[model samples]
Target: MRSAPGEFEIIRDYFADAPIGEGVVLGVGDDCALLQPPAGALLATSVDTLVADRHFPASADPAAIAARALRVNLSDLAAMNAQPLWFTLALTLPHSDAAWLQKFADGLLQTAKAYGVSLVGGDTTCGPLSITIQVTGSSVKPLRRDGARIGDAVYVSGELGAAAAALPVVLGQKLAGEPDRDAAERAYYFPEPQLATAAAIGDIASSALDISDGLLADLGHICAASGVSADIDLHALPVAPLARQLAGERALELAASGGDDYQLCFTVPQEQVATLEKLGLDAVCIGTIVEGQGEVHAWLDGERWFPEAAGYEHF
Candidate 1:
């Protein structure tokens, strides 16, 4: 039998050939990657770690895990209206299985290439399975959480709650029809980073973020940063069909507070709302920013509504 691969062997055999995009002075195989940011543009960077059984199932396909890991980190750049550039991976594995490593690397590099990002450098070590990725990008006009103002309109891209509702199916805690299972897996493992949507609204949005911790919870971040509150029309939320199919009447609530959607939620000033409409983007007005101290109020049919939980908490 072939001996299990070592760290260097794994790196050489798997990740060294990642796409070398523009501005990468040096890529994988270096102790530290050398990157060049666009002239007069700011660098936007974010990192995330996904642990086995916490972030994903331990028995999940390695490729799917890798794809999800990179895509989620890329969502951060999209939130900042940044252009994808480079990334680094630090992977931990309990054992170095070549087949598993190949699948993981293929998924990682494919997603990276699709996003126009290059794998710069990373490390591999022996431990429980986990993936840590740091993505860096460039932004000329970065949207910030603190930019929202009272009277701004809140909007979200695509649909929501599908990923959250999909979780039960993904974890095998709930049995689903094959169609539902496929939809759940797609929602959970392949959330598209809203790069194009961000680009379309970057100049007009007052504040922006990707919804990873449900819409309400992530929107609260913008409210806190901008020192404003929001009043949402719960009936106006564009609930995902997957959520509706799986969660029944609770779909709306799941859409509001079940995390993992990775879609963009942004605020557009009343004046620029017309401009946003002219762009004809795939987003819908869900609420309005109001004068308050970071509270998010929801109303259903002119009556107050509440969610069962705030969102996913690390603790």
Candidate 2:
């Protein structure tokens, strides 16, 4: 038999004191989480969770945990070109440790402050040390994956595969003073969500999304969402030198099927190439969205490169 799911009684006694945001006439203690949407701007909301052994190591630094937990959610807001305004955190720690909470909260506040976001509310409880943050943002017109069109040039904001490369090291696999271990570990620990870059994309990019589930899989999302297919040049993929050092010639495999790279993969009209170039985003034209459907293709030196696996999948 399964254990009973957590109930509101448990939620209220522990987490009821957290402040509700602006215009929240009646807060979470009641029958529902009631709030009035902020004036003028459209609301954007996203929820993300980080599990101890799954998303990060149990031994991972608290500050890094706090930062990454927030960054990934912020990446979703960025994809919509929304300016994050506030967030609610729900933390489930194995046990209440004052020092750990202090460090984690401090990191959360610092990162939120840097992004001009406030912690409006949250819930805390006892569990297996998991963190879930729900964030809200404001936007004039939110970008959607449905807008991609044929002939649009697909671009990614930064290098990929560092986080995937770090997986082995996280599992206690020894490395020979390898720099990829450090780089990939950093990528996994402190994932830069490219919020500013994504925000700047604005109407320029017809479609956009953060690459959390590897390049090929996430690009497949855009294609499926927009009813299009993409032809990515495997050689054109911006493989970081550190990732190259780690995987050797199989670097493309890492970039293709390795997940956890939170880079923004987007499509822009060919006309906006110059504008995006001026942004100095370390952007690369990796592929083109075409009028088709189904799996995205990776062309390596004019031949197809099909990985034995697709990407990281929970369950």
Candidate 3:
């Protein structure tokens, strides 16, 4: 029989030491975590769930899995230009191992503290390995998908393709110890949420989203929501150098259609490009919103192109 611990014991041992953020009026051990949203700011909430071998490899480190689970949710908040306030964790495990739980909790709480978020409340149960996190944030005026407009320039933060490049190695398809493989592993395990950039350019961004799905797919979402189209320049993508190790066009394909990048994709007016540059944001101008509805056209040397695959969708 698998060893299981009591729910309260799980909480007491693992989640008790979570940081207390400014918005947490009441924290763990309560029926409901009480949160006080900041004055003049609307609460932004997002939830993400990761199952073993689906969202992550079963062989992945527990701490890395925990961090990725929470960070994905935090990336959503960042997309809205929100400040993280609090979070609740729901955990399911085949069996409770003190060491594994402790490591997971350490990663979770440490990440929360780094983002100034508090762990408020949650539940623990015996089941398959899974984690669900609900994060609440605040924003005076969050960027929305519907806010994109024609003539807006699309921008993406950071480099893409590394996390996707690491997938083969993570699945044991590629050998470890390669230079690019190591970088891909780091990118896959520790994707940074773009909170600082989001906050800095919040007022300037017309629409914003995180690139969990491939860039083209997620960019298409903004266009669909805004009833527009996009023309992306292949030459302008901020692809990571790790992708150069790939065969011809595979790098661009990964940057276009491979998932798990978790970078921000946002739209801004051409007039605001100087303002964004002055803000010192790490980004690249990849495309422009046009009149067509929901269509994303990729261009290389003035010709239309498309990625070989679409983003991941479980169905």
Which pairs of residues have clashing backbones in candidate 3? none
Candidates arranged by lDDT, highest first: 1, 3, 2
Ranked by TM-score, top first? 1, 3, 2
Worst 10 residues of 1 by lDDT: 1-10
Lowest-sum lDDT 10-residue window in model 2 = 1-10
Candidate 3 C-alpha error for residue 217, in Å: 0.3
> Candidate 3 residues 155-212, lDDT tens each?
9999888788777876667553454655656788778999998998888999999999
lDDT of 1 by residue, 134-201 (tens): 99999998999999999999999999999988999899884545547888899999999999999999
Pairs with steric clashes in candidate 2: none
Give TM-scores for every candidate, taking all chains together and pairing residue i with residue i. Answer: 0.96, 0.86, 0.94
The lDDT per prediction is 0.91, 0.78, 0.84
Candidate 3 or 2, higher TM-score: 3
Off by over 4 Å in 2: 1-38, 180-182
